[model samples]
Target: MSILSLENVKYSFENTNILNGIDLKISKGDCVSIIGTSGSGKSTLLKLCSDLISPTSGSISFYEKDYNSYEPINLRKQISYCVQIPYLFGDTVYQNLSYPFKIRKQEVNKDKIIKFMKKLNLDESYLEKGINSLSGGEKQRVALIRNLLYKPEILLLDEVTSGLDSQNAKIVQDLIKDLNEDGVTVMWITHSLEQSESIFNKRIQIEQGKIVKEEILK
Candidate 1:
């Protein structure tokens, strides 16, 4: 069975239809790149998949069960969603990163976090830096590292590398490729076709809130 399935899902905002009948089945370890023009409902679709918003019509199933069947907190833990402009809380970067462990009652693994930071070109001292002092790219990297602390079954990203430079973007892409190889299902929305073609095995094109094309890439 597919890890996640969307059957004729639709969403609307104030009587304006944002997504109309989207059907998708994402299998385990599938790294799908979602691309489309602006206002084509790409982000909205990710939000629905993440259970951040309810679908107006049709159903979404996770692990063969109804998506809403699980508690919100538990569901969100398994299906991680990272938006382009992430929201980081607390004073220091350490606080933001440690919350995941705190909620799970697991001890904060500073060594692991530091390792991840090193991979992202962030040094150990970054843990003590204030969130406000970091640039947009830095904040995005920290938020991503925090989400990966628990290694969710699925990763839903929306233009996560948009604010980064070419090198940083490549770093993020490489990390995602490694995670997908490790068996994490990924659905990433991006405007850069070049980037999408390079990292994803499947490409989905959306237009006016509906899927226009879905292709398996080489």
Candidate 2:
């Protein structure tokens, strides 16, 4: 069975249509890369899939159940969304990293957090640094680690590597590929064609709010 499905989904805002007739199915461990020009409704589509916003028409289902059937908080726990411009809260990196555990009433796993940080090329000492002191790439890495702490069923990414340099982007891409191999469903939005081709098993292109092309790479 498909883990997530969208049937003829349409979304509009302020009287303007952003997405038109989007139909997608994500199975377990499918790595989908979304590519489109700016203003092509890529981000809006991700938000809808993550349930941050609802579609104007049609339906979305998770595990064969309607989206509205699950509480927003509970659904979000399984469908994690990482934005292009990450929002990090609290004063220090540690606080931001611990927020996920705090919300779930679980103890923070410092070792695992450190392990993810290292994978993103962040040193252990970064935990103590003030959020304001870090660069854009550093903040993105911290936010990503926070998202992975609970190991969500589906990870929705919007240009996650936009703030990183080439080397750091490659590191993040490798980590994402590894996670998908471990059975995490990933839907990523990226403008980088090279990155899209290199990491994704499936690719979709959106143009003016419609899927213009779909390809299977593997």
Candidate 3:
């Protein structure tokens, strides 16, 4: 089934086009990657998909429903975006991890958090530490776990592994691969051509604000 669809979508800023007549259809549980050079509107396309930015023309739909019809908070719960530079709001990791539950007025899932922490190579003791003490890679992993606790059907990632050391990068890469294998849809943006080639089942290449090609790997 089609989980998300963009039809003739276009976006512009100050008369400069970012995306033009872009059409994409994402199937449930399908892994997709978006690739293009910098300034090619790859990030812009993700923002549009996540409803962070509205298009100048055309439409985006989720599950055959118009994007604008759903409430923003409710929609975001199903489509999560994890950025490269993760933002840690509170002072401590526990506070950050509990944020989702706090906002939802629900109980925190400590068991699930611990389980995911292990899978992401984080120790339970780290959760008690302040965010200021964490390294860059640690912050990124925490951010991912925090967002993923809700189990969003579609996970949007932007250069998720860039700039990290081999170990941290490998931990993230393996974790995400397992998530997709377990049936969470993933769409990511990456600069490494080799990473893009190796990870994605289908790659969409954009150039000059247009989808130039779609490549499916073996």
- The backbone clash count of each candidate, in order, is 0, 0, 0
Report each candidate's C-alpha RMSD, comma-separated, in the order given: 0.7, 0.8, 1.3
Q: Is candidate 1 or candidate 3 better by lDDT?
A: 1
Model 1, which residues run further than 4 Å from truth?
Answer: none
lDDT of 3: 0.89
> Which of candidates 1 and 2 is the stronger one according to lDDT?
1
lDDT of 3 by residue, 148-193 (tens): 8988889999987775787878788888888888888999898877
lDDT, candidates in the order shown = 0.94, 0.93, 0.89
**What local lDDT score does residue 199 receive in model 2, on the 0 to 100 scale?**
77
Ordered from best to worst TM-score, the candidate numbers read: 1, 2, 3
Per-model TM against the reference: 0.98, 0.98, 0.95
lDDT of 2: 0.93
For TM-score, the strongest prediction is: 1
Per-residue CA lDDT of candidate 2, range 118-199, in tens?
8999989999999999999998989999999889899999999999999999999999999999999999999988988997
Candidate 3 displacement at residue 104 in angstroms:
1.9
lDDT per residue for candidate 1 within 157-198, as digits (tens), equals 999999899999999999999999999999999999898898
Report model 3's TM-score to 2 decimal places: 0.95
